[model samples]
Target: MTAVNSSDEIAPSRMLHRLTVLIVCLVWPLIWVGGLVTTYDAGMSVPDWPGTYGYNLFLYPYKTWLFGPFDLFIEHGHRLLGAVVGFVAIGIVIAAFWKENRRWVRWLCVALLLMVIAQGALGGVRVVLSDRTLAMVHGCFGPAFFAICVILAVVTGRRWRQDSDAERLRSSTSILTPTKKLAALAISLVVLSYVQLLLGAMMRHVQPTTSAGHFAGIVSTHILTAFFLWAMTGLVWLRLRRCGDLTLSRPGGILIFLVAVQIALGIGTWVVNYGWPSFMTWVPGSQSFLVQAKGFVDSMIVTGHVATGSLILAVSAMLCVRLFHRRWQAKQDRLVAT
Candidate 1:
């Protein structure tokens, strides 16, 4: 196998790379929660952007912090977390610029960093303009940014760049056209997940208050898109299972399981609570069976759903990267043998 060597002086797989990946993965969930904080109209709970109560970020007033209300604090905390994510993104991008093997990979990281900055600005715009449209667009971009980070992490991981020509030639000998097909299905599932995420952002922006036809349309569209996401995930899993590639197939199986649980929680929240509270929680202070069901559905459910989406996307991309690297190795081997 031809090693994927860098012309640059620095290498990416050092301890810093792993740390960066870990940080990005951890930040992804916070990004989604930030989206929710805005989607639920909680952005102005503190009546500020980028800061709270005239203090910068972490230095907000203690009284305001501990007041008889928690909405502002939640929003402020989201902003603070976003700032941390931004710093981590910048660091990772700079690391890529100096250390990555491939020139294209460096450029990709640069583009993603720029997008992150733009996303941060959009958050400010969403606040200053008080425009739901801007808020919705910002919310939608958050997941895309998170997905990019996930891709970066996957690329930096051990299994990503390490391809074996010997194994590839062996794999190729097994009539693994089915494996290629599974790779395609994995790519499709990732794309569909992004689409579903966008639809969800749109629904959040609409925040339908009444049982009007428009609200029902939004709800129906959201639910149906979710179903499509689930179906696409199933296709990914099925193709991977048939491919018989244990590495790719195993991760695909885990992703499918995550999707199943995510969909169940989604259904429970929507069908039982009509998607109230806008926070993925049960109706507050209610003891009814419906509220109880919603509460059970709420805790960890939304977080799990978003987190799982990011995970599935990361896993799918990793599988594809493996396939392409293996193909490159195989082609190289055949030339050497000839």
Candidate 2:
């Protein structure tokens, strides 16, 4: 909404920003592998928590896991990646506390550390109890954890750090430039998309427990949410684009692209899992299509759908933060000019 003032530039701890970026990079692949595990019903491959087949997770025989059954390889690899992310979470806080001048940012890093720990425990307990519901919960929390990492990555970077000492703008609708509406709309989209994600999880992990009628309701709701999320994302993109700020418009563009890809993937996921819908039966080649359960094409499509949903949330988080950052910096600049 406003040009970044060169005179306003401030340096942040390079190590903290680097660690934050590293975790953000690592978390997305972790989500993809987790999605794959779910796609193939490989949650129980290791049947142990914090370990692989009773061996220390890191010390587990590579020959067995690396060359083991496909499910075991993915499941164990997912655990290994999670462990690595957990360690990075610790490093993020240490770097933030040691070098970051902002007390609130340090606390955010601490919160990130705690969230990753809780998320890890959720995954482990889901394993020990063999609870699909907890598995879904774990799946749901991963995006939120990734979101915080994205937030950390954005805030710790030079763009945000440049305004390091400005008092936080009051959380109100007054700060949006050009229009006052983007703040609440962006925030709402974040929450709505997350709800859509939960409905998706219900379909993926809790379908067996749901009765036919109940499951149909969920499917209907999921479809409706996707339509609504698509429209909301479009609206946000337009607003961000019109703002004429590259930093803001770029994330908005990324969000819209992810949503478009996600919608196509969603369709592919539906077709591969359930065949053509009754409404599409009259279309060419639709009658010959058959649902392929766990087939390579179907698995990758479904897994991509899941991972893209997380990406949508992650980018949405970045845009929301950028919007707020712009508003906050604008307000600070006005105050200084006065």
Candidate 3:
């Protein structure tokens, strides 16, 4: 067997990395559009799967789609954006297989491709079945797909494969002594964030037919989980900062900032969607206030909250991957030295 240098085997391809970055950029907006669809209650606007009003997705009349009702506009636009992301995922898979040498990287791209296909299918099935529960599952799946895009971008970037700082850090076990604990915390945050997002999705997808008590229970749990997620993410950021690793600290800081913004947006979403809860309405004998449903401000705030939650999840996942990569590399270095 020919012995290939590990460094040579994993040589980074700038083009492939750029392609992955493009997919990430495209998928981020796809997630936002998906959120908007849920926010406006427009998931069933088209009333068909993989098509718009019996026309092929791409063949839908541009004029009607553009000048149609608000629900149709966002719903169709969401489909259009999803198609673009799907195409981009295909490109990533092809590029990875052709231009990238790392076996794991190639297979990860294939996994991404599969995930995109599954997500699209899930959306289509939700529409055809007219199932709100399926819609909630579809909503939860979008962020997971987006997180995979982030992972692909991070692993393929020059920073991941060739950064001198990363190399040095990987060689010095002493410097990474706290990384195990920090990485564990980061992973925990990622899991907690996903759970919170699932709860939020349940709240968003609750049908008008659902019981008031059921809705209230989901909302209460979601609100309480928000505070827990905020505190846990904050602690992770603080610990990462103390560790003094820029790679970890930078994303950690971004996660913390995003969590803060998400909390504000969460409040705004509640106010815009269901009026202020009685506890927060300050005026004497004043009822809670709600922005008009599907209004501009309401949609934007609710969609932004959903989008930011995905961003926080992506950042936490990235940080966890980087930390684990360094730890693995450091272990390998110690073995080689011994």
**lDDT tens string, model 2, 1-338?**
44355333447889999999999999999999999999989999888888777898899989988888999999999999999999999999889878887778889999999998999899999999999889999999999999999999988888776443444333333434635588888898889878978999988885565798998899899988898888888888888777766777787778778888988898888888888777778889999986655787778899999998988898888888878777767766666546
Model 2 scores a TM of: 0.91
lDDT of each: 0.64, 0.84, 0.82
Q: How many residue pairs clash in each candidate?
A: 0, 0, 0
Candidate 3 — worst ten consecutive residues by lDDT sum? 1-10
Global CA lDDT computed for model 2: 0.84
Off by over 4 Å in 3: 1-9, 163-167, 170-174, 207-210, 283-291
TM-score for each candidate, following the candidate numbering: 0.79, 0.91, 0.91
| Candidate 1, superposed: residue stretches over 4 Å from native | 1-11, 35-40, 62-68, 164-180, 207-211, 275-307
Record all residue pairs in model 1 with backbone atoms less than 3 Å apart, i.e. clashing: none
RMSD of each: 5.2, 4.4, 2.9
Better of 2 and 3 by lDDT: 2
Model 2 CA deviation exceeding 4 Å by range: 1-10, 162-178
